[model samples]
Target: MLQLGGYFKLIELGLEDCVSDIDAQPVYGYALYKDGKGAKLFYPLEKFNSDVSGRSFHNGRFIQKMREKAVTLPNVRLEQGTVTSLVEEKGTVKGVQYKTKSGEEKFPMALWQY
Candidate 1:
């Protein structure tokens, strides 16, 4: 699946059968928040002391790196499909339900959010 200018090879909705280890490469960006008065506040990510340098955080580059690393793993399968919905129990998310060209299915999702 493609999202946020990045291409994702989604087998499921989670990371259980996906990436082994992920590194935190902080990217600098601004978040816009609106107040009750309709005034917008622009918060720069770097100012929050997260140590983001705005250097190694290119979307396309990151996606390419992930794709490269994923191919090197054993028994990794990338399913071409569309996520129909998330399987949630109470307040916890269990997995995801997706639909491919063949039919609909479900898998144990290890990761839920980006």
Candidate 2:
């Protein structure tokens, strides 16, 4: 289910937990998941950023630099519910229904359908 899909984000990418060089961005912490597993958070990839001083993302040192500091995350979930029905008004879909850990809820929306 870990398909790396393309999407969009509208905010700044924050720093993550890593032991990078002084010039590199250092990771400050970790993220734990529900299964007692964890992974290092990193600065969201900036396609334009680079370290021309080094091997340009080819260096293997970065691998060991991370494994040496492996972390653990537990009790993590992305969302509480699956998107339920898409409500329709006239020809436009205008709402969404969902059930969370607590119960059900609805969110009204402007619609777009193919």
Candidate 3:
């Protein structure tokens, strides 16, 4: 898990520091049931040891943290808008057209290149 986190630069971004016991919890496993019967299956995280574990977190907070970190980087723009359409060229997506409070805007894919 540490190696995977490192690959995504989570360590460099100090994302681990954002984890709090209040929002992040350890989830050992889950049970599913149907028709008021006992759990049909018991899925444990430890069984898939190398892939993922029993860890739970608040998605909203995690996304907020990512957005906060993203906006701090050069050439990064965080806009509050709804994507209206895709800008396609030669059968490929080139950019996006979005609507904001004031007006509509076009964000080309080229602008995303760093």
Candidate 4:
């Protein structure tokens, strides 16, 4: 899928596979998935006192640098969901039931045919 300006591979969709042609973030947010664990894109919100000094507390300078260079994160959406069930018909993999922000919606989804 494409996002912002880059793209990322949707290795899997929950447990039921779903491939998309739309820009990733155009559909969802950002996060990371590995080893069956889910991680969200969030950095710590630091606090500073008026007496504090040294490096700037907000180190968003890195993000600023990337923006300056026109470099950006890949287009990937947070698959914020879990597979509830599989829709099968006559032993054929038909569709999937997944939970999104819109609750569970089982639409006819097939990659090869999509």
Candidate 5:
């Protein structure tokens, strides 16, 4: 998954530092079990190159890092809320409708167009 373009895009967005330490406790591999016995052991290092083999990390930490990096950008805005639905126009997603602690809000995509 780390070999995908989206991961590189994050690096391009100035998140290279965050990527290195995204997880507090990194998982390099995993084992599968059946009938209380180890069925198979899988390790990225054994199967793929170091560059493409990605480690598993805490998802919460990943989100935190992404939010932290996004806030530093001038054009980004972070909102805390539940996304009720997507606001689409024609066939494209044009915006989002969400509910915050205070009230419901609609954010138009045009506001962020560059």
Candidate 6:
């Protein structure tokens, strides 16, 4: 049930539209640890392959698409503020407390927190 809900959220977050291609090939490479001190890796979103990679979309592209879709939703409102804390009760999140330019505000997220 939780997995299904997560799939729906991905759709709501515009995962389909953000993905420019679904058949992109994977870039074959591995992380190299130089002298057992530093490591380097070059994995870009465009080089992702669903057949090989665990993640479907590149994180940055996914985030950009979600933000674009969020603005079009009637129920979802974009808030410009720094989140101070999350309200929780009985180990469940109930709301989010954030500070805006005008004042501090509390927005209920009980329906989605679980």
| Highest TM-score against the true fold, candidate | 5
What TM-score, over all chains together, does every model reach?
0.38, 0.24, 0.52, 0.24, 0.54, 0.45
Q: List the candidate 3 regions with Cα displacement exceeding 4 Å.
A: 1-9, 27-54, 89-94, 107-111
| Consecutive 10-residue window with the lowest summed lDDT within model 2 | 1-10
Could you give candidate 3's per-residue lDDT for residues 3-69 as a string of tens digits? Answer: 3333236545566544443365644345677788756443343444442323466777766866777
Tens-place lDDT digits, model 6, residues 1-114 = 113234445456556444444332334334576666766564443653343332344566656666777788777767677777888899987777777878867564443633
Q: Candidate 5 lDDT, tens digit per residue, 18-43?
A: 65676543344556878888865444
Task: List lDDT for all candidates, in order.
Answer: 0.47, 0.40, 0.57, 0.40, 0.61, 0.54
Candidate 2 residue lDDT tens string, 1-114:
101111111012211222245234323234657788767754444563442111123235545544444433243223436667787779766766666767756464333333
Lowest-scoring 10 consecutive residues by lDDT in candidate 5?
A: 1-10
RMSD of each: 10.9, 16.5, 6.2, 17.7, 5.0, 8.4
Q: What is the lDDT of residue 25 in candidate 2?
A: 34
Q: Model 5: clashing residue pairs? A: none
Residues 1-114, model 1: lDDT tens digits: 123112122323333222223343433434455664444433344343443223324456556556665767785656556788787889787777777878856564544434
In Å, residue 95's CA in model 5 sits off its true spot by: 1.1
Instruction: Identify the candidate with maximal lDDT.
Output: 5
List, residue by residue over 6-108, the lDDT tens digit for candidate 4: 2122222221112222111232335889999998863322452231221221225434443433333364223445567777889887766677777866454
Error of 4 at 54 (Å): 48
| Prediction 6 global C-alpha lDDT | 0.54
Residue 8 displacement in candidate 5 (angstroms):
5.9
TM-score of 6: 0.45
